[model samples]
Target: MKHTIFYILFLATLSICNAQSELVKIEADTTNIRIGEQFEIKISVGETENVIIPKLSKLNGLEVIDSLKTDTLKNTISKKYILTGFDSGAFYVPKQQIFIKNQVYETDSLLINVATVKIDTTKVKKFPIKGIKGEPYQFDDYKNIVLIALLLISIVLTTLYFALKRSKDDQVKTFVPKLAPYQEALRNLKLLDAKLLWQNNKIKPYYSELTTIVRNYIERELHVPALEQTTNQIIESLFDFSDAKVIETERDTIKKLKRLFEQADLVKFAKAKPLAEDITSDRKIAEYIINNMQPILEEENSEVSYSTPVVIVQKPVIEKPNTLAKVVLILVTAAVILILSIGLGKVISMSKTSKNQMENVQ
Candidate 1:
């Protein structure tokens, strides 16, 4: 029993000098302490990587209200331990353990006292709160100039892109839009007439104009390239577009155009003269070409509706001023000449008679 007591006392004394683990330090802001005084206690471990903070036990006569820590970095992880108490008394903070690697270390706890600091109620002082002032600026003229230049360049580039796009759009608008089917056909007919090509013995041009008018109409209204198609191809394409019964009536108009074109080709290329009746037939063919599609022009493209202009000019067979006017003017002029000669002869014969009678009587 005596030996055992001695061994325990030696261990206790060793504990007072050094705790159970590796090297660590515990410190307070002040050694003499008072109650209701709040301060910080720092705990550190030596040559270590990992540190652990166990929940601190409540000190006798001290009430801890709040505690907090700070940011930790990987190389040296430091932690701030803040402790606050409101009760006034003396207290001994127990020893703490800091963990390093896998081993444990001990730190001596600080002892502090809390004594009330008396304040005279009659005296009061105000505490001021401060904020950090903004840093002063140094002027940089070149940087300002560069920034303004970049802004101007960006605006100019953006404006140029839009302006170029608008200009191209305007160009397209300036381009002549495609004429309506009947408008094109009529315009072409007017051009054909202006040439008076028939009088020039250019039957081919006359027939060519008629055929082109018809083909141009087909191409526009039907969306077909009728200009490039043969007569047979035209008929075949029309047939394919609709069943026979519906297009059966249109076949005659198609044939009329085909015949007119063929005959014109013959006169132009083969030097054949057309029958007088064929000329009238060609006019009829033109009428038929436009008449057939007039209803369609009204039905489709309702937004910008199209129409065929009526050709109100005199027909060739009508009594043209050239054909009859010269004959009438000649007959009237010859009658006037005959009347003047007869009157002059009568006056001369009467005068001679009268002279003869007078001579005989004398």
Candidate 2:
């Protein structure tokens, strides 16, 4: 009886020592969860050196969603796994094997419960499905249409501007019967008199118009470009023409013209106000100049008629329209119409679809 008692004590001590020598431990953060819910499992080993932690690849009624790397701190190495269960039932995290140096260690199994979510159907209300809603229109939806409209307006305005400008220019260049040089000069002088310029204290304008008339007459009759020449230059050119036998003019006529020009220049450039009598005298002198040059003009015309028969012909100008611009405008207009039609059709179709959906819902 004493020997049997000692042997039983020795076996019990050995069993306790083996229980305390366990190196692998496994635990779980939670044991209860709803279906499709996740939990975590932690594994620890007391030894860090020469240990290999195996991955938890499979579980019963559960999935190993994630496996963490082994962590070492001081004398402990640990691993973690994220687990999720899809079925509502009790699941087991099976024992995991770990290798240490020359021995294999196993962790105890863990239990988990996954329950289905509960809902009280009596307290919950049911709702019918809603119809599809149409989205509100945005500026971006009509951006192309607006851009095309603006482009079309700009093109039309540009075309109109050019067309009107061309028409105005053509009107300015339209044919009008020209008066003879002498008659035109006389008519302008009479018009100047009717203006009452000097009487209205418009001295400079009066002198300017007076000088312009004489210059224009000389330019048209003698073809001397008198309008572009200075007063002194005109006198010199007239003397040259006399020397060249281009005109039959007396010294008196040239002197009178020189005096008129000098007085007009004084009024224009020096701002000198001429006396009323001097203005009247200048006007008379202008008429004298015009009449004096008549005989020379008649002589020239006779010589021209004797030499060659002249015919004056006036031709009308016709400008061709911009065919390329028209073609581009037509194409762009068509494109705009086509895009608008497509957009309208889409809108109508969407409206009909929405109406039908609403009717079905009702």
Candidate 3:
């Protein structure tokens, strides 16, 4: 029994020694390198659980350029240190400690040799240092500044052109009649009749003008946006007015107006041509509708006078010029000009200085 116990203790000690030997290891990529050359030192641990790598403080004749993070693969954890040396000598990378699951382990030390670069004086010729030389200026040197200045000028000119054109276009003249709305509408009807558009193969224009006059009258007198509304919408607005006791009119009159608008739409869009008698009857119906609505207008606006003369004159509408925009544009233009001038002066001065430098060297 005493012999067996001694043999078991010896086997256990051997296994512990083997585990300590295999746990941590250190290696170098190369033992010899030239001065100012970089190399790597790798530390590998056998165990992967809760391993901590000690910080490397300093190394003699070498610098720790970088330290890579620990990498885990299956059962091993590994890290790498990038080292570079500037001195021509041999250096030893000292041992590093590792902590794994509350147990301490150590890595083996490494050696690296740094060699100086050699030159042979017999094969190489020596020359004296020369003075600085000046090169001639080329267009490519200042091309960017010149191109930028031209682009800015072009943009400013384009903006100014559009602004002036818009200002000119804003000077438009509109004609507004001095006569009352009802009187003006009646006069327009008379003018339309005098034109005899349908008789001269202008049926579309005749119907368009006829409907426009009536719609304008309704809009002005009834305070409804009849001109912007569709035919059905106009009729519905009229019905609403009637329901509110705003205006009293026969349903037949509303239906007649609807029919007239529909016929005009068919003539204009669908290219339907009515008989001359039908056209004349439509004209009479337009007149009847206008006369029918005049009494309602007088009742609503009794204080309005219809004695004003029927004179149409041009009323000019001039938009105020954008003063702030013009100011900003002027400032921008001035700034660009100033920058270009400064850049040009600098280029000319540099060219002169460079020319003098070459002359002096010669």
Candidate 4:
């Protein structure tokens, strides 16, 4: 009898353990939720060993927004689901099932309400549409535009500078120095000799050119106004110079020049032609007088001081600007500056006016 009673007690203990493993419970944070709002639904099962959790995607028109992992404390395992609904109405959380060791267990059904958020109409305020004010003008607003304009101006100025410099260079490249007075007179005489004008029946032209050479040479060598003076006037001037001993020349040179001038005046005004022999002889006399009338150098009677080779240094010759070029450059620069100044003034005035208008509107 005692053994039979002990066996029944062991069977009772096994049934109680199986019943505890099949127990499942569910709870929620709130029974009411606003439309589009979320709530949590937590489920707890009594045991984890050999438990097969049921998939619950949707319940009573409410969607499972998110599902958390199952958490275990002692032998109980709990799971939480984040749920939400968009439509406004009452919703029922239907019985959810949990399986353990192939045995099914269920939780109680629950009710929930979804409604729109309530607002007090009497407390709300109505506002009308407002006019937008104008924005204040700022220099930083046009920083890029101003910078670009200044850059362009710099480029134009630089281009003009280089262009004018290059133009000046080209002009300097083509310039030739003029021949001096004595060298020029000598060259003309040689050319006139080559012409042989008297042999070609051009005695008047020959005598005129010969007299011109003699007059120019006298003026250049002696600093006398021989070309502008009459033949008698030139002779008087030369006689004075000789009496003063200013020029170391013979009176015969003056007489020869006066005779050449008289012959030239007769040929040019009276149309008298001279013989070829007279023309040739006159050319020789003109050259001899020029050579003789040239300035003579005086020798210094001082002791020599040269130890090394003496290097004579001449002063640097500074070239002056051509009058016409200076005038043109000044005029052009003034015009450009005037145009730019006017344009800049207008731009500044416009900007100020625009800013004032904007401020007034605001």
On TM-score, who's better, 1 or 2? 2
Candidate 3 is scored at a TM of 0.42
Which stretches of model 3 miss by more than 4 angstroms? 1-140, 143-178, 194-196, 222-259, 296-301, 305-362
The residue pairs found clashing in candidate 2 are none
What C-alpha lDDT does candidate 1 achieve relative to the native structure?
0.63
Q: After superposition, how far is residue 89 of candidate 3 from its true place, in Å?
A: 11
Global lDDT of each candidate: 0.63, 0.82, 0.84, 0.77
TM-score against truth, every candidate: 0.32, 0.47, 0.42, 0.38
> Over the stretch 20-47, how does candidate 4's per-residue lDDT look in tens digits?
5457877899989998899999888988
Candidate 4, residue 101: CA error in Å? 5.2
Better of 1 and 3 by lDDT: 3
Worst 10 residues of 2 by lDDT: 166-175
List, residue by residue over 123-233, the lDDT tens digit for candidate 1: 877767554433333345235644655565566556445433323222211224456777778778778878877767766667777777887787777765789987778
Model 4: residues with Cα > 4 Å off, grouped in runs: 1-22, 35-38, 50-56, 59-69, 84-87, 92-110, 133-144, 147-151, 160-362
Error of 4 at 182 (Å): 39
Best by lDDT: 3
Clashes by residue pair, model 3: none
Report, for all candidates in order, the number of backbone clashes.
8, 0, 0, 0
Please report the TM-score between candidate 2 and the true structure: 0.47
Candidate 4 worst ten-residue window by lDDT? 166-175
Residue range 152-185, candidate 3, lDDT tens digits: 8999899777765534433445454467777878
Best-to-worst order by lDDT is 3, 2, 4, 1
